[model samples]
Target: MVLISLVTGASSGLGRVLAELLCEKGHRVYVIARRKNLLEELKKQCKNLEGEVIIIPGDLSDGNFRKKLISQILKKEKKIDYLFNNAGFGRAILFEKQNKKEIENMFKVNVIAYEHLAALVLSSMKKSNNGRIINIGSVVAFTPLPYFTAYNSTKSAVYGFNRSLIYELKGLKVTSTVVLPARMKTGFAEKAYDCYKEKGRNMCIEKFNKIAESPYVVAKNIIKNMNKGKEIITPTLRAKMWYSTRYFGFVVDFVMKYILGPKERKHLEQAVLKEDYKNS
Candidate 1:
């Protein structure tokens, strides 16, 4: 039987890698992303794969788009075997210095879209008695990072949602797995920095880029864990460390702060100072 997978944010990064891997493994993938051109490119690259690629380009933050995406999928496919809620982005900035619209967009894409899409697909999955919902989260969800308050909070929501969903689907074959990945060497950091710059400000991402892992490697680990029947997937050593130390709030916070490096440290200091001055 051919498996059907739906991967959101499949234009780039881990999402794109995951989609490609799925296609290579003979699973038909329905991918969604804002970059239509990149989606086309991905489709072309995977044309000769064992499986196939179906593109649905749209903004995840748009409720109508989400609905239409589901509708289109249901119209074409009978049941979705895998749901990869990998569509999200973050901006590195102090909470007080963040853009309201951007923050809202983060919540919509990271939290709301994941939940809404899961809900829309759950009934079909439950009725079919088979499906895996993979929610792409971040280590920041477990260990909070100072300048990424909004992004971290949204990921925390994803973690909670997936965990609770596991219990909710008790006794069912439908599994909810939350993937908490560490920094990945993908377009993610660049996009986040660009978004922050668009807000007319500078933010530091040098440290993150330094320790980021390969998106292809991350995607491979995620699939490995999925096959292992794991509910919580922390593929990297760094990601596993964050998961293991999740409860050590003070230690994690201190380590996270220092991990920012000097450049980001100075950027944070300046951002906080500016915010304090404005408040005063």
Candidate 2:
């Protein structure tokens, strides 16, 4: 039986890279994103790939859009072998700085959309007898980030939700895995920078540049671990180490405060604000 894969946020970044890789691996790939032009370009690019590529363009933040997307997918493909809940966005700002609309929109896209889509796909996946759900989480979810409060909270929620779902699905044919990675070099950073600039602040470009990994690397690791049916997959070595030490709260606090220090924090905030301001 041919495996079918559904990937959201597939117009760019990790999602796009992963979709291409999966197409190359001979899996029928259904790519979801808001940009029709970008998705078309991706379809063109995947023409030579082994598997078929289908473009599904719609804003994930809209419930009707998500429902329509699932309905259309079911009409075409009877079952999806893998459901990749990779569509999410984040911002680098203090909690108070973000307004109600922004907060709700983020939650809608990052959390609600995933939950709705997962529920839509679960029954089919369960019936398929072998399927996987890969959720893209973040390392920031492992610890508290003062400035990136909402983003951190959403990721933390994702971690908790995926874990609970895993427990509930125990002994079932469907398996769930959460991919946690540190900063990755993608359009996400640029978007965050743009948002900060609009607020007359700049992002910490240098700090992110130092730690970010390519989206390709993140996608590669995800595919590698997914085949093995791993429960929690942390891509980068630094992220793995950081998550491992998160059990020791005192140590994490001391290290982040003293070792990394206030100086670093100030510098990051300033740099981020400056970049944001310039972009704005």
Q: Which candidate is the best by TM-score?
A: 1
Clashing pairs for predicted structure model 1, backbone only = none
The digit string of per-residue lDDT tens for model 2 on 10-55 reads 9999999999999989999999989889989989999998987899
Give the top-scoring candidate (lDDT).
Answer: 1
lDDT of 1 by residue, 107-157 (tens): 999999999999999999999899899999998887776667899999999
lDDT for each candidate structure: 0.84, 0.81
Task: Look at candidate 2 and tell me the lDDT of residue 32.
Answer: 94
Off by over 4 Å in 2: 194-203, 257-280
